[model samples]
Target: MQKFLFELNRNADFQSRYLSDRRDAMNGFDLSDEERHALAEPDIGLLFHLGVNGQILMHFAAFHEIEWQDYLQQMRDGIAAHGPVREGVYAVTGYEGVDAHSSRLSKTSDAEKGS
Candidate 1:
C-alpha cells in the first residue's frame, strides 16, 4: 500500500493529466459504452486514481485552478460520508508514504496476513 502511495506521489503530474481527461468526459463529453462501463465498474485502483484525479479536476473546473488544500478536505469529506471511492476500497489515513486502501496486495498475501 505504501509503495503505491509513493508511486502516486512521484507521478502526481501524470495523475493530474488523467483527471483532466476524465473530467472532460464526465462533463457532457462523449465516451464509448465500454469506457463508460469501465468507469462505472467497482475497481479500487481505478477509483483511487479517479478520486485523486477528480479532486484536482474539480478544483480547476470549480475554481479555475488547483486549490489542493481545499480539494483534499472536500475529498475527505465526500469519502467519509459516502464511504470508500469504490467497492472493496477504503480511505486510509496515518499510513506513511502509502495510499490508504491500496489494492496492490495480492490474494496470497491477504491469506497470509488474514486480512
Candidate 2:
C-alpha cells in the first residue's frame, strides 16, 4: 500500500509508465486483488478503511482533487455503509455494533450527567 502511494507520489517515471500501461505498471508490484481493485477504482474510502496512513492518504486525496471535508465524509460514509475499518491502526472491534455518532452522543450525555 505504502509502496503504491510512493510510486504515485515519488516516481514521475512510474507515473508515466502507469499512465501508458496500467496493467504493465501494476504487474511490478506484489498486491492483493483487493488492493488492485481499490487502486483501480481509486476507492479512497476503502483505502482509508484499510488503514492507509493519513499523511499518504491526504496527498492521494489531493491528487484526486478530493476536498478535505469530502475526504472526511467519505470515511464516515465508508464506516456507515461498509462497517468498521477492516485492518490497520484504525481498526475497531465495536464499530459494527453501534452507530459512531450515537456512541459519541451517549458519551456526551454521560459526561453531562456526571457534571
Candidate 3:
C-alpha cells in the first residue's frame, strides 16, 4: 500500500472516537452514495517516526482500498516497509474483533505502492 507517515492528531480520545464511528459506519453494507464515495477516496492518515530524534511524521490523508483484512495488513506492511522493522502489530477492533497488521506483501501490492 501507499506509505503515509503521520502523527496522532489531538488526544487518544480522537482515535477512540474515530474507531467508534468507523466501526458503526462499517457494521452494515447499507451505505449511501456519499459514504461509498468517501470510502472509495484514498485518505489514510499514517503515523511514523521519520528520523533519529523523536520527530513526528504526519500525513493527514492518503486514500486506498482493499479487503478489510488486507487493509489492516497493509498498515503493518507499510510500517515495516518504512518504520522500524517489527515482527507484529496487534489491536482489537470493535467491528472485526482482534486484528493484526503484518509485513506480508501481496500480488496487488504494487498497485497500492505508487501513491
- Each prediction's TM-score against the native? 0.28, 0.71, 0.22
lDDT of 1 by residue, 42-90 (tens): 2323334334345333433243343556645655654555455542123
The candidate that achieves the highest TM-score relative to the unseen native structure: 2
lDDT of 3: 0.33
RMSD of 3: 16.6
Off by over 4 Å in 3: 1-65, 84-115
Question: Global lDDT for candidate 1?
Answer: 0.42
Clashes of 2: 0
lDDT of 3 by residue, 1-115 (tens): 1111121233455345444565343334554454333333422212221121112212223222245555555445545555542221321221111222223244347658865
Candidate 3, clashing residue pairs?
6-46, 6-47, 6-58, 6-59, 42-63, 42-64, 43-62, 43-63, 44-62
Choose the strongest candidate by lDDT.
2
The worst-scoring run of ten residues by lDDT in candidate 2 lies at 89-98
lDDT of each: 0.42, 0.75, 0.33
Alpha-carbon shift of residue 92 in model 1 (angstroms): 14
Error of 2 at 97 (Å): 11
Q: Positional deviation of 80 in candidate 3, in angstroms?
A: 0.8
